[model samples]
Target: MLPINIIGYRRIQNRVKSLIKGPLIRKVLVLVSGTVLAQGIQILASPLLTRLYNPTEFGYLSVYISILGMVSVVASLRYDTAITLPKDDKLAANLLVLSLIIAAMMSFLMGAGWYAVGDKLVGYLHAEGLKGYLWLMPLSLFGLGLYQTLSFWALRRKDYKALARTRISQSVGQLAIQTGVGFLQYGQIGLLLGDVFSRMGGGGGLAVQLWKKDLQLLKTVTWKKLAQTAYEYRGFPLIASSSAFINSAGLQIVPLMMVLMYGPEVSGWLLLSQRVIGAPMDLVGQSVGQVYIGEGSPYILEKPRSLMELFYSMAKKLFAWGVIPTAVLAVSAPWLFHFVFGGDWREAGTYVQVLAVTYLLKLVIVPLANTLTMLEKLKWQWFWDIGRFILVVSGLELAYQLRFSALQAVVVYSACLSIGYVSLFVLSAAALKRHVSRSENELSKALMPDPE
Candidate 1:
């Protein structure tokens, strides 16, 4: 029994060490470095941006970006997500072309619709100044969709360096444009331009990287295969599209509601607090998710129980990622906001503190989310996202009706959504644990071959 216990412990220890040396962690380091660099640039630029743009400008920009977030999920019909799933490069390339074509059409449709009803949209937002920005949305959407597709392609190929560089380029292009425009008093248009131009820059980088590294794969793409692949992954476009939107809505809805209930200035406060907390979390979570989904999905198909080893390993990593920084930020949010962005942003600090728990929970949940995709649990993900969206929307609305102050509303939103995040973590862990135990039994049988 003592020897058996020692053997079991050693096996677990070896698996953990393997995870450390594995491609996923190495790739995560590269991507996380780039992401941190990009976010660092944004963080450094925030003081100037907050000074130049004002809360009102930021609020309007939030509205624009939130809308973009919601729309961009469906822009490629969600086919880009499947880019990494297919084992065949030709099939993946076909998925890529299909995504681009869908993106182009979506962009054109949006541009035309905006041209038709631009004035009404302006009236609806009560931001008459945003009217001119309407024309830019389609172009921004196109770039956004294309970058997403290319990012997935990069992840599929494990081209972490290129992905990292594009992130830096986006930060550079966006900051350069906004800073130059800040001197001209272009108001929110400056922010919108930064958003669009950053996407363009990132998209351009991705295109170059895709061509440089995966040119042969691209050359293999044929019309017949492209169409067939499109048909094959139709479930992604059909099922994932809505799930993505609903998931996006859970986050974006708060900003939209802020605009209506509290005004753009308040929306701006919400945006900054969210950004200050969310951007770094997203940087880490996104990098982890890309590797986990792209790499781990294959294991689910071949050695699902073994994949649970990877899942537990990632859970440990995510837990390590969540605790310290979040606790520190929760403690220092107010002083950091006031000192960094000036006195006007003191409230945003409070917002950050109030929502820190939600952000921590979010950090824990994001890396595990790719597990659902690996398990082909799209409908369950959709259901989970639906619950989140409802909880968030209802919580915010309830706060508004109760005459809760803006900060209080955010607190309510955070509390309700954290519950959903916990649920997500628990379900994923339970599912993976069962798989791990089952697979360990098999692993033991395989080990018997080693004994005399």
Candidate 2:
């Protein structure tokens, strides 16, 4: 006979195993495991990185990353997102090619624009240190674009394992280069190079896999098909891309504004805080989101109630998983920063404390925001993005004008953004409800007897 506690433990373990045995949960586990390993590498390296480099250097690196993000988000004109929508693999292949072509063109245009006016722009932004590194932007944009397109292609194919491998490759490549360069005393440029390397690293592996598995599909791609698909999915570029760019800008602009209002050192503190808090949150959200899209897409129109259940279930899981971490950070961020990252970073922890709730809200909402895309609600998404961008920018500007300190400014920013995210959740839920109602109505009509 077993003791009561021992039997209960065994039962709980069995239940856990059974829960994770589902295909959706299993796929999420694979991506989450990869994300944990990859982000863990960077997270573990942060203390060393903090000691190796100073706040100002990290600040410059943050600015570069912000620029890279703003461009990379729209590099494929968001056609990559549409890659998963088509029923035909051949159509998806054409979207993949179209994305690549758009990326290349965007890269060339960005490089040309930089060459024409990079100097003045750097000077105006008070980012002179970034001038030498701006040349890498176009290259990084192209790599990021390539990786995103391939990632969506893999998502469409339900190739979660391949996607997981690419993440590991990116982390390893980034950590190696960044650490080596830091040891060599390359300053912020090392961080910049490492970031660029990260953008490019996983792309080759994804590209190789794509080529080997879909060479026949690739061969079928043609100019006519590309053009036709481009027209077919024009809303992605015109609306979704615009919305994505605005959202990206809203995110990246914070550090840029920090740099402008304070200095690189101040921005550096914010950057570290974001890196520590935001990165893990984003990776987890994104991992869950990838699985949600792959798992939930088929049920969107056919069984919207199933999709709604999945959405609510994912949101609940994310919220529950987020609570402990958010509380820990809210309570202990300052001490944690001082102890782990040295005294210089205690301020960064303050920023984390102020923004902890915002990050938690973001963790829950961002993953499910894909609901908008899945439902073809691009216009609604666009409106929300614009409004969020306005709220963030105006709120920050108000804080600055009122002579609020950096921490206070972050508080205002966080509060405003939290409101925005709450609105977003409501919007998404309403969209899902509307979808469910319509689905139910259609089913009822179909089941009704003919008047004749």
Candidate 3:
């Protein structure tokens, strides 16, 4: 009986495996499994992490990370994002080089700024043990920025497997370090080190993997080419950079503000709740976005109507995945959080519930928002980013000043952000529609014979 049951189970496993053997399905499964495995590691570790590092430690770590996140998007002047756009590898190489150069410059500037104001900044964030750690942000940011530049290059290579593997490696490195450091009683420094080192593992590995294939291309990156590509993609630096920065602020500023307004304890709770929720969100949304941009960007540019179709396809899929799961989380967060992370963390569950709608909207919109870059409406992107940032900051700050509960403030911020995200989606659809219209007009003109 046991042998028969084992044989049956093996047959089912083989059948499932054989079913996903097609190219697109295999790629999606690899990336999805990698992302799921990575997030699973974190989600599984959260209970242990919560036990090992107190709320205050996480609070400090969140502040450090928020600052890094906000600044690092601009590290490459958003040129890393343009790596997939150019058909010419030489042009892409030049863009890649440009990203590294700007990343270094920005990282150095951040370090310089920190050197001058490290103490004031620590005092401002109420960071008791973060003065020395702040110095590490520049290095962390540089690694992260380099990773972004190369990851986009990898995307151009269609190295989705490598990308998926890196996600797993990063999580493993982080969890290993964090667990070990917790035992050494290093406090928040351990969490910070774990994050930085783990990120380095992923980004550094990807950079090294690409170096061999791209070594000759790297050599070909002349000053003339770099200058030419940078000038050609000037819109990225001019328009996309601010837009990306502002978009980052919409997500990251809340943690920094929480620290300022509600102290580390409340901020810690918020950060933990966000982490748990974002784990799944990122696992799905980021994986989808990566695949979408990798496969869809070129098609979208060449066929604008296809871009609109892809947008609809992604919107429908994202809607199905986003709304219902979040509603469940909102309803069950309190009991689930308390059970999983202990009693002290129940407050974060409430915060997660309040944040559910905003996060859902973000989940739906962010995956589709890359279409804006495809259409060169980064100006519209900048506009929407400003709107989101303003909404998040103003709503939260006003609620805080009015003495609303932290949860209440988050609710207000979430409502505002949800509205902003929906608005951006509408704008993105409009942009894609216009792009299709423009392409059609150009095609019609080209097809028509010249009058003699």
Candidate 4:
């Protein structure tokens, strides 16, 4: 048993090390580096934030983030997905300009909507002071949109080091602001201020990098051409962005609904689950998607077979890496939460344990979903998401009608959502294979020797 274990360890170690020798591995490493640091900061700050603020405070913070998160997608007009697909960087710049124009237009529209409906929006969430800081919504949307664009650019340039630095700076800045606010008894102000400071760090850094890169060549872009270019790959990004908004920001609607049905304290508990379960996701998932999409696109174009094989291999790697950590959190969450966050968050452990399944499963499928964007299979991806949306919405509604416990409802709700995510993985991989086969056939035709 000892010899077998040692051999297994050496084999796994060799495979993992070999992964880093490829260019894609470098991007993945850089992206992972950023996520690691950012996650470290979040881990450091989470205890303080939890202790300093109650579930109600977190609930409010979640709502603000949800609103801003949804609006930021609208602000980008889906150009964030286009940065890597196009062969020409100049064309990509035009896509950026187009995203900015849409962002500006949407900002005006959102600001107007807030002015007219601000009270009701806050009232719906059952929170006060939302109207007072309503102005921050639009400003934060701009910041988020610009930051996303810049991040995409860094991805396209394969500037993962810069990207990682920016992410760390932003995380540190946010933690500082929020921690300071906690000390001053500023309540939700801390959360909001932390967000603002982080975006300033991230977006400002991107702006400086963009200017220095001398991408001024983009200035020559024509609006008409850019619009047409945007139209070409528009379906995936546009639908994908909408689905992300719905699924992501849509989580807030659950807490809001729970609060309306059960009360604020229940809502707070649900929010706590989110923070705990969301930790691994924020720490690693986002970074993996960033690098996988950025680096995978070019690989698919140049060496389709190698990319497909790597995709499967990496999926296994991600699963192996995530499983043990997920299991430990699952087993230890209740005790950890009770000790670190007190009775108010004692249930957080259960939440973490329940949701850890989703994260571990996600490690298997999420990277493969990038194939949808790589192959321009937007319509297929959209269908997958819409199906998931229906399942999730339906499951949640049924859970409520049945008067399920908050814990049961969340677990079931997430299980339903995970189904859709897994479905997308299967569909995206199939689509990529079909595309690769067709490309090979075309190449074969072009290269066949002309025999008499």
Best of the candidates, lDDT: 2
C-alpha TM-score for every candidate:
0.80, 0.84, 0.81, 0.76
User: Which residue pairs clash within candidate 4?
Assistant: none
Ranked by lDDT from best down, the candidates are 2, 3, 1, 4
Q: Which candidate leads in TM-score?
A: 2
RMSD each, Å: 6.9, 4.1, 5.5, 5.9
List the candidate 3 regions with Cα displacement exceeding 4 Å: 1-19, 286-324, 363-379, 425-452
Evaluated against the true structure, the overall lDDT of model 4 is 0.76
Per-residue alpha-carbon lDDT of candidate 4 for residues 231-331, written as tens digits (9 for 90 to 100): 78688565667776665654545665665555456666666666656665655676677667776777776788877887787788888888898889889
Which prediction has more favorable lDDT, 2 or 4? 2
lDDT of 1 by residue, 82-182 (tens): 98997878888899999999999999999998899977865676555577789889989999999999999998888899999999989989999998999
Each prediction's total of clashing residue pairs, residues at least 3 apart in sequence or on different chains, is: 0, 0, 0, 0
Tell me the lDDT of model 1 at 239. 75
Task: List, residue by residue over 5-68, the lDDT tens digit for candidate 2.
Answer: 9999999999999999989889878977887988888898999999888888888888777877
